[model samples]
Target: MPIIEMKQIVKIFEDPKRKTNLLAIDHVDLNVEENEFLCILGPSGCGKSTLLNMIAGFEKQTSGDVLMNQKRVDAPGPERGVVFQQPTLMPWLPVWENVSFHLKLEGVAASIRKERAKEYIEMVGLKGFENHYPHELSGGMNQRVGIARALMLNPSVILMDEPFASIDAQTKTDMQEELVKIWEKHKITIIFITHSIDEALILGTKVAVMTRRPGTIRETMSISLPRPRDVTSDAFNRYKRQILDLLKEEGELAKAASRSSS
Candidate 1:
């Protein structure tokens, strides 16, 4: 069985003014296998983040079901870790403390927590910065701390919602390479949300493209490109061109739908 399954998910948000209910997701179905890097790509307002939220158990679907390991998911659990757009670290705490905070809350001893945090900090390339606070680190370095914190939990899956969105282009590329290294080393399952097709292409084992508002999975295509994918290669461009066409077609359809509704 697939490790994660979303069967016919639908999410509707209420508008306070009774103007109209917003259907953010419409009957979307998806399944992810173990240790797969699945990147979800869509235009803004396409509910890509919403889908990730559901998988993380931060939100529930309006209809259908979300299952992990053949069991229904109703609330957030430690089995699924999440890294949001921001590091969301405790500014006052140092990197080691932030990475092992959950363990601290669970009444783990300080020595054990420190030792455990050490493993993940090194894994994320933050070995010597254990004493550094969030403010002392660069954006990409802080993001790496967030990733280490998530990995500290030894989660079955890690859900990322554009965790590198705010970084510079060069920093973003470096982080991407590090993330791929992490994934390759640990063989961790990841579900990432992004608007950048190139980023998705570079990271995911497969990319799932979504439509605009009231988003649904338009298609899920396997990358099949070799590691350290040559972006300049013919195969790479072909995949890029294919996804571009899908996005363009979806954009046009969304605009037409809005015009008709108005």
Candidate 2:
């Protein structure tokens, strides 16, 4: 059974000054299976983040339903963890403390929280830096702390919104590789939003492309490339070409729409 299901989801934003309702996402249905890494790909302003927000329960859809594990998602819960573009860590706390903040909220003892935190810190490859502050770490290290924090919750799913978009290209690649390794070990469901075709191809087991604003699913593709994917291989290039062509077509359609509206 699908772990996450969205049926005819729609979102609209009201503009009081213009007396208009801006349609963000059109009726869209999607399903994510257990242990699946699903990447949502789209152009800017195409409602990819909006759709992810709905799944995260940060925003409610105008219509339709979002179901996870056969339950309706009406509010945010520990079952779903979100990592935004920014790490958003607490500057005052040390690495281990930051990772165990949620445990602290639940009134867990300090010794127990620290013990639990250390395991995840090591899992994310941040072992020796447990006592360091966020300001002392690199952007990628901070981001790993955020991931560890979310994982400490033991959530059934993880939602990532272009978490590596701000980092340098090399760091981003390293983070991607680490993420894939972590996912292989944990086997948790993840819904990641990104505009980069290469990133999606590199990370996702399946890719779902969205159209321009008033976003709808353009296509859903299963990636069959082997683990430790070879970007230079013929199979990799073939998939890349296919995704690029789809995005190019959508880009032109978006341009035409803008011209017509003007």
Candidate 3:
């Protein structure tokens, strides 16, 4: 059985002005396999993030269901860890403390937390800056801390919401490489959300192209790209162009909807 399943999920948001309910997601069904790296790619408001939120158990669907390992998901648990766009770290806490925050919540001792955080800190290549605050680190470094914090939970599934979107090109590439390395080493299942075609192509085993507002699954293209994906390679460009065309189709539909409403 698929490790994660969403069966005909639907989510609607009521708009007071339109006096209408907007369907953010529509009859979306997906099955994610074990240790698979999946990317949900679409334009803004396509409900990619909303789908991730549902899997994280932070949001509920208007209808249908979400299941993991044959059990219904009703609430957030340590088995699933999410890294939002922003770091969301505790400003007052040091790097190690932030990474070990979950353990603290579980009433683990300071020494134990410190030791556990140390291992993840090193995993994300943030060893020497254990004493630093969030403000002290660069954008990419802070994001690494966010990832490390999530890893410290030892969650089997890691959900990322455009986690590298805020960093510079160079730093983003570095982080992406490191993330793939981590995924390979730990064999963790990752469900990533992004608007960037290149990011999706480079990272995912399956690239799930989503439709525009009232989002639905348009296609789930198997990447088949070899690891250490070269963005400049011909194969990479080939898939990128194909995915771009798919997204363009969604964009045209969105424009038509806007014009009809206007």
Candidate 4:
């Protein structure tokens, strides 16, 4: 079975007084297979995050169904882990504590939590920084802590929302490489949201290009390029050009709609 199934999913934000409420996602259908890295790419306000939230059980679809392994998603569960744009860690806690906070919340023993935290902290390349606080680390390192924190749940799927967007270019590239390594080693299914076509090309096994709001999948393309991708290669640039053209069409349509509506 596909790890996650989004069937005819539509998401609308209702307002009692307003005649027209916000309709973010249209009737979109997608199947996320097991152990594949899927990247969702679209313009701002295009419901990429909304669609991800639905799969994470953080938001309910207005209609249709979002299922994980044949089960409908209604609420957040341990089975679906989430890493947001910001690390959002506890300022007072050290890296290890932040990583194991949920275990602490669940009344897990301190010694066990410490050992578990060590395992993931090391996995994310933060072995010696376990004792360091959030403020003590660089932006990229803090995000690594966030990734380790999510991995602590041992979730079946990890949903990320532009997680490396705020980092420096070099760090972002390095993080991308590390993430690919983690995906390969763990064999975990990941659904990542991003605005960068290059990042999508680098990280995804499958890329879903979405249209402007009332966002739906414009196309889902399988990316078969070899790992440690060379962006200068013909195949990489071809995919980039294709996505750029599709996004350009959506941008033009959006502008025309604005002019007509006025």
Local accuracy by lDDT, each model: 0.94, 0.93, 0.93, 0.95
> TM-score, each model?
0.98, 0.98, 0.97, 0.98
lDDT of 2 by residue, 1-262 (tens): 9999999999999999999999999999999999999999988898999888888999999999999989999989999999999999999999999999998989999999999999999998899999999999999999999999999889999999999998999989988998999899999999999978889989999999998888999999999999898888899889889988988999899889889999
Model 4 per-residue lDDT tens digits across residues 1-262: 8989999999999888877799889999999999999999998999999999999888899999999999999999998889999999999999999999999999999889999899999998899998999998999999999999999999999999999999999999999998999999999999999999999999999999999999999999999999899999999999999999999999999999999999
Compared with the true structure, model 1 gives a TM-score of: 0.98
RMSD of each: 1.0, 0.9, 1.2, 1.0
- Model 2 misplaced stretches (Cα beyond 4 Å): none
Off by over 4 Å in 3: 16-18
* Candidate 2: 10-residue stretch with minimal lDDT: 46-55
| TM-score for predicted model 3 compared with the true structure | 0.97
Clashes of each: 0, 0, 0, 0
Candidate 1 lDDT over residue span 98-207, tens digit each? 99999999999989999999999998888999999999999999999999999988899999999999999999998899999999998889999998989999999999
Pairs clashing within candidate 3: none
TM-score between candidate 4 and the true structure = 0.98
- Positional deviation of 144 in candidate 2, in angstroms? 0.5
The C-alpha stretches of model 4 lying farther than 4 A from their native spots are 17-19
For 150-176, candidate 3 gives per-residue lDDT tens digits of 988889899999999999999999999
